[model samples]
Target: MGEKVLSVIPARKGSKGIPRKNVREFGDRPLVGHAIETCRESELIDTVAVTTDSQEIAQIGRRFDADVVIDRPKQLAADEVPLAPVIEHAFAEVDGEFDYVLCHQPTVPLIRPVSVDSGIRAGIQQTADSVVFVVDSTHHYWKQTDDGFEAVSSDRENRQLMEPIYGEIGVFLSHRDLVTRGKRIGGSIEFHTVDHWEGIDIDTYADWQTAESHRSRKQLVYRVTGNDQNGTGHIYRGITLADHLFEHDIVFAVEPNDNIAIDMLEGSNYDYQVFDDNASFVNFIEETSPFVVVNDILDTTADYVTALRAAGSRVVNFEDLGDGTEHADAVINALYEHSNPPENHYYGFKYFCLRGEFRYATQKSEISSVDRIMISFGGIDENNLTARTLQALAELDDQLYVDVVLGLGYADPEQLDPIVEALPDNLQVEINQQVQSMAQRMEQADLLITSNGRTLYEAGSLNLPVLSIAQNAREQKHPYAFVSRGVLSLGQAAYVSEEMIRTAVTDYITDETRRETMRTALADHDIANGIERIKQIVFDETHENR
Candidate 1:
């Protein structure tokens, strides 16, 4: 018969550093349950068991599908009782003889099944009596001499120059006889090295917090505010960034009045919460204590970013042109035009956050004429840009067929009905709202008349010629929505003369060569990998800090 390995997780109910530490919740599972589950998941482990005097810990172990629960005597459950004897007692309680006895501490819940299995295989391969997991010790030891405190090691000049210092971790694998003899490392010992993060042992309140953070450390909190007045661009931007961070815990935070943000986040795998005001939002951030906070709101003050930083979160801002950019760890302004932003600020089309649909989208087919025009001004169109554009389109040839795309937050449907009804009999107009397939709709149209928002990037990805109009003064700073990038910028919607829109549309319709040139310009840039670049930055920060 093949060798059998028994995995034992020692989870005593009596904890001095933190009360009920063994049964305390770490992430979604109890502290001891993590160890039990990991042991059960290990391929090398033939049996999984837990040794505890407290029935509460035993119950938790059993609930996690542990094979056996050994009720340790009160003598072994004391604070000073060594883990070696506890492991031996648990092994004795199990029926079958085990070639290898593994002792995993419940406090180290971050330990993985693969690591356990690898350590066992390593022990067997090395023909060693014991195998212990360890991590590199970066800290230099100090000893108090008669004169003063001095460095323990002579080679204390630099960390790289030192030989090596490894601290023993919580995992131990030993021969069954050696464990019973109370000699875990008396025989030949093989060392299994793990990273510092994985080897963290929770013994105190601070250690518990560190472990808990490590357990839920990948959380990325997105703070976005959008509504009918301002539009849903911020919400869409946050969602785009969230999609890139799929492996991390994603959360969207929005203002209470922003129903558009709510509707967008509905049914999404990510969690969403609404804060009544800015103070409440800051409080929520402080309480959640996320690893990273991504702010997609238009502008941020120094106070807001400073408070978030004080709350213990790494901050990243999107499209932030305010003073908060000075304090933010990283700023991504994918829309704004800037030749030289700060070192941390990533601007220009190179950093443009493209939606998933547009990233791999096939090139849009070219039309001989601009008969099919798409008029879109983002979610709310607070200034009613859609109605204004339609008014200008009415002055043009009736042969023009307009597809007016309204955002989910569009407030005045009644106001638009009269404008549509008064259009010429020959002119055909259709309205599409809350479209799931924005790329599909863009693909159908040869030309797009839209505001300076994320849709501009989507249009450029599909090589769709755009007559872009800025929704507001802030949007007028958009760097990519210029004539050089295949877009005819009509300036801000409020100040732009109706004749300007009519002329730009009329000129583009007649000039097939110009339209073709614009479309070719749109196809020149490579934006398919922007999402990947953003992911790399976020993940790199997470791993380095971890």
Candidate 2:
């Protein structure tokens, strides 16, 4: 005992912008087929009809399972005739009596069935004569006066803070009586707001291309963690990847108590969700059913990946060596080196995803002497290597300039303060905490002292020689820095003494030939295009499944 709704889709034969656009292939179906399928799938719509002058469009409508295909008259299909008369002609031709009539345009094929149902429900609930779909316009409006062009509004505000202006989306739901009166919109009208993509009206070739580009957009979820234990490399990488995927819906999923990741993401405009536990996260993923789930946490368990796959999400893991990597559709371990990796695994420095800053940074030039040295120990500096490296540099009798860039999660600031206070006059040390641009800092330095992590790849991009100290056993497993000879590895920090670091730095500075060789090796490697490579992998996987 509900109101009967009839959906009438008008797809005329003649098109001014694109010839025969009504039957043209869109994503996977013809242009008119999208509207027919959307209307047929709508729960509130009782009957779906397509009124078109072209026999080809009528056949496509029938193929898409449209309930009826009304033959529009030649006179009513004229270019100048308004849509109200055509809707009236279709309403009269349809046999069934409907309480509501929905006029859907085939040009706007991106409209979803849920939006259609919502418009109908709003019309019925509000008891309005018609419901018209609209989208909020963000563009600044202008008017041409006698003198010159002037702003439409006197109050000028930021685009984001501006008051909302609505534009019609060419789709409307009207009462049956209004359709008989040759009027689709009249009297008490209810406005239904839809997303910008759903409101795309294809009139020009550019509009068609825009709609096609939006058709491939999908929901992407990044399951990442950032803390003192694992450091914030994963979180930074996730943010960089999310920046490139602006067309899709991106969400960052973190652990319940991971305030470090939350605080970091607050600076970003992306949406994030914090889950209580593994079960809750999995349940949320299942409900969302995202197109892709990217895991940036160091390692993942088999059970966790299985749950994600069961949720119908394409799984991609970064720098993961756990058993779950076996089940992942794609595994990218740019930090670690493998002689032979699985077909799905992309390993080595070639897959390294550098930040945008490094991609455009100027490569370091050869120096006659090492004047400025940079010391950084990744984000967390769990082993307090920054202090150890600084202590090593202080013992040197040579007068040198040193810059210590501290990370956001550096916990041993107290330990670092004492080392800087007692530094000899020969070593002019500057302590920089949470520096904005790592690339700019690296460009100013002749040698870089850092942990064996993503930072090495970043330095390599600039052809800057590095003296590396492995923070842990897992970091020692990464052999690209050592194999490439770009970094003089001092082994693990626990085993490496102050004297050992001093010797390594002293040898690198004195042996100009070795430094030049290292720089050349780094320059020969191609790591700048890793982001584009990873983007291709993600889009290929999502597109194949779609």
TM-score of each: 0.63, 0.96
lDDT digits (tens) for residues 262-354 of candidate 2: 878998867899887779989998998999889887788999999999999999999899999989888988998777788888888877888
Clash count list over all predictions: 0, 0
| Displacement of the residue 69 alpha carbon in candidate 1, Å | 23
For candidate 1, write residues 1-546 as lDDT tens digits. Answer: 267899888888888889988888888888888888888888989998888899888888778889998999999988888887888788889999899998888878887888888889999988889998998996679999999999878665688778788988889899988988976675899999887878998888898777777675587788887777767777766787777663577888888787777877885555898878778988988998988888888789999999998999988888888899999888887787666678777776766778777766678657577778898887778778888888887777638778888977788677898999988876799997767777888888888999888788889888998998888787888868873558888888788877888888889989889999898898887666677666655544432110
The TM-score of predicted model 1 comes to 0.63
Model 1: which residue pairs collide?
Answer: none
What overall lDDT, based on C-alpha atoms, would model 2 receive against the true structure?
A: 0.87
Worst 10 residues of 1 by lDDT: 537-546
Give every collision pair in model 2: none
* Top candidate (TM-score): 2
